[model samples]
Every structure is written in C-alpha cells, then in structure tokens.
Target: MSALTGAAAVAGCGGDDAGGTSSNSPGATSGGAERDCSLKHPVCTAVTSDCVAVHDNQGATTLGLRMAQLTITKPDVLASGYVAGLVTQGLTMNLPQCNLNGTGTFSWLLEFDTTTGKLRTGGAMPTVDPREGYCFANMTAGEFEIAPTEIDAPLTDGAWSGEAETLNVPIFLETSPEPIILPLHQVRLTDAKVSADNNCIGRYNVEGLEWDNACLPGQDGDPPAFINGGKLAAFITLEEVDRVIVDAVKQSLCVVLSGDIVKYGTGADTNTCKRDENDQIVLKGDWCSATNSPATDDCADAYALGGEYAASAVKINGLCPQ
Candidate 1:
C-alpha cells in the first residue's frame, strides 16, 4: 500500500503514463507536437469482466472513477440580463443558465453495491495515487485502497440523492506534479445511475467533449453508448474553486440577488477590499495557489457548487510502470 496523496490544480492534465496508452499513437493524432499529450479516452464497451472484487471478502467492490466530467453551471453570471438580476432580485431566484466544464484528470474510488447491481455507488479517492500520481497502465487493484470518505445513500428507483458530510478530492489539474486537496464541506451526488453490468457507470455526454468517438477504440462494434450522466454537487470553499479558475478570486462574484450580504464573507475575504459603485464588496489579491494551500485558513468554508458528471469505471488493478 502507498501513503495518502492528493493531486493539485487542474490544467492541461497528462502525458507520461504507466500503460503508455494515453500518449501519442505516433500514427496521426500527433498533428502538431512530436507527441500529442491530449486526453485520449479508452474505447467504450460494456466489459462483462467482473472487476467487483472485495478486498478479502470485505463486502465492498472497489472502483476507480477513471474519467470524470465536471461542470460549473453558470460562468456567465457577469453577463446575465433579466435572469433575475442578482443585485436587486429576490433572495432565492434563478441565477442564470450556462454550463462551463471543469477540466483536469479525476481520480476517484468507490465501493459499489454488487459487482453488477444498479445505482450502487459510494467511495473515495485512491489512498495514494492521484491521477498524475500513477501511470494509469501501472496501476493495480491493490493501489486503489480506500480513503476516509463516508456516504450513505442506497440505490433507489426514484429521484437521485446521496450525501457526504465532507469529501476531499485530489484533482490532478496538472499531471506531472502532485494533487490539490479540493475540500467539499457538504457534498451530494444526485441522479446517479449505475449500469446493469456495473462494469461501466456512465453515459456521459458533452457534445464535442467525451462523446461517442471519445470513448476510444470500440469493442466489437458496440455502437457508442453514452451512459455516463449524473449530477454531483457540493459547497466548495473559494480556495478550492480558485485552483480551477487559476486563482481568479478577486474578480469572482457571489451574487446574493438581494443585497443581503454586507460583505462577501466568502471568496477572498480580506480587509484590503472595498466596494465600487455597486454595493458588491470587492476584494483583491490571489487568495489561492495551485502549488500551495489557501492564503487563509478561514477561507476553507464554502459556496454552493453545481457539477454534472459522466464518469466511467476503471479497475484498481495496478500494472506495468516505466
């Protein structure tokens, strides 16, 4: 087993891998660079292989959320019109409509209900590997040790809802280095659906993103299936969110709709900030760092975060490494 590790910051994700599959094929995808280091996904197919193995009959099937599709619903809050103006509108009103996907390699683990059951999901990150932390090819099931995340929502035939008090994710915003510990005080995974065969869990779709062709080399012509789709939400601290937006906290806005909040009380809460024409308490300075932790400890609180994901399952089996 390895020590607990976390991936920091999310940028252009990866390159060097253990299996050596994700890099360049040297055929044609490498159009510009000598080896195109783009995120190439594995070919999608309903693998009937039973990967749901409990560590010594421990009553849990471990899984790694190899690919994660994250979303930030409203990035255009600054340009929103009568979308229930955040300034003068009521307290609880629809902010706006826009979806911005969060990029980065997502390394997550889970203990499913049954190897092939439906909607059985609950787990955490690998005890050690943090995406860029291990070569995907060199990973083993043993390496996918469980972390200290707890969620108790069972499989249901109704609306999706599950809760985790505090979930810390190690995101490899950048692959070469370590991971960033993105803290979620209150976390929720909604509308989560598990496939019939359980080997796969998604039907994730994002137009030009992880679509049909993105599922990689097909398996006996299984006619691209987009099954990875779900909503995962949490209240993220500004420090964690800053890592994704590259520390753009000062320019960040938490529209309260009705001028209720005297101060942001969130974001980069600093004394140096002041108000402009609008009563928005404007702050300054980079409150976060991809390579470092938050500037202030008090900033570890949270802001409502909405994330939509289409994740696929990968076994925890550790294999070859370079």
Candidate 2:
C-alpha cells in the first residue's frame, strides 16, 4: 500500500487560501492581466479543474488511513458492530479488497453466544496479509455485548463492547510528494464500547484506548507523538468493510522542522472534518485558481461556489464487496 512519507509540518491540514499571489495557490495570476479564475469566470472553462486531483486523492488517502487504523487496532469493535445482528445465527465477515491488485481479501467465520456474550471462530481464521499491517489473527477469540442492559450509560441504547491487543500497527499519513508510515507499538484497547445504532455509525468512538511509541519524524531526531484531545466518528456497514466513512478531528502539538507543513490548533482551526446532512462524511471545499492576468485576478468569488469539487475522489460510497 502507498503510504505518505515526509515531515508532518509539510503535510499540514488541507484547506484553501482566501487570497494569495503564491504560485501554489489555486487562484493565482496566470499573467500580468487581471482574470477571474473562479468557477464563474467566463474565460475559465473549469473552475474546479485544479482542485479535483489533489482534493480527491487526499480525501481517499485520509479515509483509507482512518479505516486501516480502525481495522488493525480494534477488530473486536468492528466484529461487534458489523455482525451484531448475526449474534445468534452466526456470520462470516468477507472483507472487501483494499489494495489496487484486489488481493487484501480477509474472512472471519464467527459464532456468537448472545446469552453469555461469548464469541469464537467457527473455523481456521484466515491469515491477514502482513503487507496490510492489520493484525486480524489476534482477534480469534473474544467476548462482546450488544445492546447492553446498563442504565445511564452513554450509547446504552445500541452499544457493543469488546477488547483486543494490537502490536506494532502502522498508520499512514499524506505528505506533499509521498506518504508517511508511522508505527504504533504495543497498542491495546480494553472495555471498548462501540455504538451499533444506524448500522454501527458510532464505532469510531472508543473507550480505554492506549498506545506507545508512535515514532513521528522530526529534524533533530524522531519524537514520540502525543494526542491532547480528539474525536473520530465513522459510519460503516457489515456488507462493505473496505469503504468505511470517517470524520476525524485531532488536537495536538508537534515540532516538525523538516518541511513547510501547517500547524493545527485546538479549536475550529482543527475542524477539517466535515459531514453531510445524512451524517455521512463529505469533502467540503473549493479549488479556486486564477490567472495572473489583470482581467481575471478576482478569483476570490470562486470560494463561494459552494459545491464539492472533489466528489470523484470519494471511494467509500462504492466500497461494496467484491
């Protein structure tokens, strides 16, 4: 799998600038003439043309990274939510292919005893591809509780509980030219409470989450990354495990001295996560580019077009079983 490789500073949060003359800015002057390069520009044939490729690629990479992290770090949480309805009848989870060559197919035949909240594999568990870095084999046996009868508990209405142990899981991030791979060592999740309402939409929220040695790159030397606070929300269905929709917002501080990356703050500045009315994650932003020409310099209005220019970059909707 292609992972983002570079310093975090250069791979800053994705966003569009209001107005700038930087060549990297989408709406910069093409020539000496003032030209309106916004989507409404009469001369500009396509306003979103520049934003399409980068936007879509970034969105896909982000979604894939999030899904892979969730899957690798906490399979029990997923099993409980995706297969909650089949507790008594039993089910085999056929994971969809996540790679380009259609090879990361995984299967788990699980039988759940709803009466005792015990879960066990019915047959030999399929070996997860090591290249994918998801430790599925460690989830062979576990216990789960769907619709726990606890009162005054958050997500009590449709909550699932489970636990697992993960070692050296890899998480990917997008940089300017390449992807960066970070190794999370000795990670463990216990008392994981996942919400199964609306088909496991609340599976992103976890309880008792801990990790060690997240080796992030730095100038002086590699430093351990820290998470001050964050919220990750996802919507997933059992039929499609590969195309999980996710919205993640994190508040953290890191010293990246290698590249020119954006520093994320703690408030709305970190609200890069966006979702639609249906609670499905959506890429929201405009890609406005302007010519240097004086006639088309007013590309500021391009931001107001108000539509997802990176719709083609989304893959979660079509992540059906293959």
Provide the overall lDDT of each model, using Cα atoms, as 2-decimal numbers: 0.34, 0.19
Q: What is the lDDT of residue 113 in candidate 1?
A: 41
lDDT of 1 at 276: 52
After best superposition, candidate 1 residue 11: deviation in angstroms? 14
lDDT of 2 by residue, 25-143 (tens): 21234562432222222211221222111112221112211111112112222222221111101111111111011112222212223334442221111223322222222221112
State the lDDT of candidate 1 residue by residue for 1-322, as single tens digits: 0000111111122223322333332111545343321233222112332211112222235434433433334322211332112111111101010011122233454444443433223233322322222223221122122234445655444234577766655443322233334455556677765454443346422232322233221221122113235776655444333333212122222322112223533324421223457743343222322223333543422345565544544444442232
How close is each model in CA RMSD to the real structure? 14.7, 24.1
Clashes of each: 28, 29
Using Cα atoms with residue i matched to residue i, what is each candidate's TM-score against the true structure? 0.43, 0.19
